[model samples]
Target: MNRQDDLVAEGEPEKEFNPGIAARLPRKTVAGGALIRDPAGRILFLEPTYKPTLDIPGGIAEYDESPYDACRREVQEEIGLDREIGALLVVDWVPVLGPWTDALAFIFDGGILDDDQLTLDPTEVRTAQFLTLTEATPRLRPSMTRRLALAQQALTTGHPSYADFGRDS
Candidate 1:
């Protein structure tokens, strides 16, 4: 498992009370975004402050914000740069969460306007660097790393995702 998986595995699942649907769906939620910036096909990832692993810059989404907006905010907060989040990437569910933990991720095509302006949030992010997907394959959350494999296959072929048609991890 690379760094991002460590964050979830570290048992620090941050929960927020969604007052919007608290009455209908009465479960605390944990939401976040994953920013994938492929400048020249090289991906950027963040090394978390409290953990020793790397992850795409993102964090828990606020109640009032859309997941897409949360993702962009996360990238800005973690990298201190502006980005354009592109297509919808992945929507996943945490099987073990006490609440309905569904994650919606958007994969944005981003360009570096100012590389020198990158900075990590002290409370959540730590370091930010760009690496090729080949370099990133070995340094991602298990689900993401596995997802990377599927993404590679999709790049070679035209299939979208094999997230459900694979060997169990």
Candidate 2:
């Protein structure tokens, strides 16, 4: 007898997979970001019109979209850059805070930007500029500052990093 039939014959109840149960499982929000750097090694930050703090060129992934694809799409949509996204540098599991849900945030390497003029989406990005990590630290939210630092470390070491709410875990 097949394994399933044998199990039943052995007086063991047959176990069945339930798609409906799986479908009803809780889901976390996902966001993707690009770690774009200038020739001087300064990281790029966007002053988003919708948010008070400066942020990287990225946004929430659309339904069913991979984080890598979301990063590329967000870079293009937010800053009008169609550059290739490189290795994933960081994956941060952020806990729920205030109005935000717990989320998985992915940061990908976006190679160097050598004098390519940026065309910021006026509706989304108010301005874009390159800043040294120290200069950026104060402008970014605490979690983002930590995430950016880890991403930079990953880029330098050629390895990925994981974090819990941007703290290395």
Candidate 3:
């Protein structure tokens, strides 16, 4: 028998690849964010015009775009900063809740900023500021708080962390 037909279960036919079949496979949403800190170690947070709570500088990845590239794109779009995105800090798997689908979120190191001016996108962001963890906790959603903590830990340890629903796993 030829190499293409070798040992095909002795009698079964080989199946050809199908794009339609592949398109129906399960998929997850991906998002990326940057963990930017000020020289005094305060984290940067953005008040989104569409959302009630504060968020980091990032957004959902576009179709066929990589998480790292998404981070870079979002940072520039959201904060008007083209700083280099550094190492991956944390990856959190968020479960389906309410109107939101399950998603994989990534946080990358954005290094420290001393006096970088940020020009916010008026349609997307209302304001951006640096706040201490203690001051930021109340402004952020619970899951975001946990994710931020894990990202900070990863930065301190020079390692990456995995989380489920923002809890370390």
Candidate 4:
């Protein structure tokens, strides 16, 4: 007998299959952005329209898009800088401590930008400017200041670095 006939003859009930929701695991947000420098070696910052704090050029990645690509795209969209991103400078795992969920944030090396190429979209970015680390420190949020410090260290050491909420992980 065929497999179906054999099963029927054995008086065994057929099993019905249901593909319900798959198991859910704790999820973390992945955001990617870059620390761009100008010809003067000053870091770039975007004045965001939505938030009062200055931000590096980047945003949350869309579904299935790599974080690296997301960073490149965000730089182009936010600041109108269509340049290739360089080495990975920092990968920070920021834990969930407040309203935001846990996040894996990436900071890529955005090679120096020429003066003429600087552009901004006022709807998303009010302005863009380069600032020395000391100048940027007071303007950046605490976590961002930590990420920037680590990225600078990585650049100096010629090695990629990782951190968990500002502490080495």
Using all chains and alpha carbons, the TM-scores for the candidates as numbered come to 0.62, 0.88, 0.88, 0.83
The alpha-carbon deviation from the true structure for residue 12 of candidate 1, after best TM-score superposition, in angstroms, is 38
Instruction: Tell me how many clashing residue pairs each candidate has.
Output: 3, 0, 0, 0
Per-residue lDDT of 87-143 in model 1, one digit per residue for the tens? 444444434434445443333333334345676677877667778667876666666
Best by lDDT: 3
**Span of ten consecutive residues with least summed lDDT in model 1:** 160-169
- What's the lDDT for residue 125 in model 2? 94
User: After superposing candidate 4, which stretches have Cα over 4 Å from the reference?
Assistant: 1-23
Task: Give the root-mean-square deviation of each candidate in angstroms.
Answer: 11.5, 7.6, 7.4, 10.1
In candidate 4, how many Å is residue 115 off? 2.3
- What root-mean-square deviation over C-alphas does model 3 reach? 7.4
**Residue 98 lDDT in model 2?**
95
8-35, model 3: which lDDT tens digit per residue? 6477644648747765887889999999
lDDT of the structure predicted as candidate 1:
0.58
lDDT of 2 at 26: 82
Candidates 1 and 2 compared: the better one by lDDT is 2
